[model samples]
Target: MQNHTIYIRTLKRAEHTVFCVEDGQKTYYDPQFKRMLPYASGQQVKRSLLDSFCDAGNIKISPTTFYWDFNKKKELKEGEAFGTCDPTYPDQLIGGWMKASKGGGSRTLKRRSPLSVSAMKPLHPLLAGVNKDSASFDRSGHSHNKIIVRGEDGKELNEDEINTILEGKDRSLTRKWIPASNKATGLFIQDIAIDLRRLFSIRLDDFEPEISQEVEEKLRESGWVEGENVFGRCLIAPVKLREKLIPILAYAIINWKITSNQARTFSLMETLAVSIGGNANKIAGAIRAKLSEENSEQAIPVVEEQVKGIDTFVTPTAAGYVATTTESIEAMDDAEEKLIEILSSYAYEALPEFAL
Candidate 1:
């Protein structure tokens, strides 16, 4: 069984809007460090990864069953027919799922997820910055709700004539505005968000022997054989699943669009490094060393240039040599293509009737 650790550096390209708020503060304050830090929860990152996979057309399962929680009993209540949960579905097998008991019984079945995601946090405290400002908007406006006034002769009357005729009635013009509290400007509300271009680190770790042997036995009964098919191999051996998922996750990280209550449209994150089967602390230490080497205030550009020059490197440790690669977009794309090919092969071989 092989354990792989992936290290990624994210650059906020667009406005990283703030969602968490506490006592009118949007940023998280670490008591140990005594500073407010910019952070993204691991759940958010995992959701984005799942969303990327669901959005991809390479998977045969419906998107609803792929990402969202599905309950057969709940669907039955709505008078909709739904199939039983298949244990061999790629998402269920890799990402894991839960089968809740009916009527709050105690027979809940849950598959533990083998994949672990770390919260996206700042690499260094110095690299993080918070925008402590408020946004103001004018909620005051005017509108003319025109009324069609007709005369007794069935002829439409002009605006002036209509106003004259409806002198005692309500006028078509309407004006609305908030009462100013000793101020002429509109209302201002405060919200905190992390500044753009801040460097953050996220780690993904995959563990082997994810599912129980009993589950594996059931899968084998359903035509799954170790080393025989892609899905089957991934079911019995987690390393194969990790190889297929890591690239897709890399792509997702490069193109993660974080959904927020704030009106932000795009994600500005860029993947700086992706180190597999290596120590994240060592990778992060290397980056921190590079950043500290230069005393210049603008260290991100210099480090980025240095990292771009790095294609592959080996770290010698007690465990042995660990291969690390800072993948490029082209390399990641090629890996994704290879993953699609593998999945297509599995689809064609396992589900011949649904093969395209």
Candidate 2:
């Protein structure tokens, strides 16, 4: 019942990454800002978090629970129903869900997500722009003009013989010339990216009434008593639920991945600086101050400075600073343990009821 509204701010640095696309180009034009900004939409950020949470095994909920639409008449095993199918389903507390009527009626089932993700924006105005690069599809060392066809007799057919056999056939034989390797060189690409060590901001806010009355009624009908089950009580108490979800969000951001043309080969970002807090401006101010320092060597120091005299939580180690997945996971584990210890110190009445 305490003020459940919580605002989380983070500053992250990524390089050579494009967060969105338009007209086959990896950039977005922000009309409000009247400029081309390196940006990621809210939907993009939320989807990444949901996917990361599911992939990392941090949350028990399936990705489909919050995203998939289900047929009411279709047979579903236990826990197979989409979160929207049952309001009381625990995962619905995350992204929420909506299902439209199948018969083309006006009826619909929907729940507003308690979590709000802001479109990621540059912390410094100078951080927004495009980076020019090129990608190649090189097949130079191999033959570019050979077209070997297998005949029905299991023998290779020469181009002349194949053409002669299909002399009058218009449907079966088709041929096109392949450009020489020199002429088929790759083209340049423009990506909206941050190449410098610049800071960017993203805000995640959790607000009041985390669960709807309809959902509460459904939970009661299912024999769920408030304060009995950790899940149930957490759902009813927005602050507690927010605390439980903090680690998952932290993991997602630290292990942040996005849609990029070159993601398959390697991560686009080389290094990152991150901090989390309930006040967006304060966190940004602290980050700016730290970055302005002449002798600062690392980004984690920003977190340390920001958390002073504030209800902010700094990940014990900067998972974002690690180079490999194993290191990232280890760092996150350390962070989660530290967070639990911090929560324990507050002596929240519900602290012992659940393992956040």
lDDT, candidate 1, 208-279, per-residue tens = 333445555666676544432322234332335434554554455444544544343223343333322134
Best by lDDT: 2
Q: By how many angstroms RMSD does model 1 differ from the true structure?
A: 13.8
Q: In model 2, which regions exceed 4 Å deviation? A: 1-3, 20-26, 29-35, 58-91, 100-107, 144-218, 221-223, 226-250, 259-265, 268-271, 288-308, 311-356
Candidate 1 global TM-score:
0.49
Best by TM-score: 2
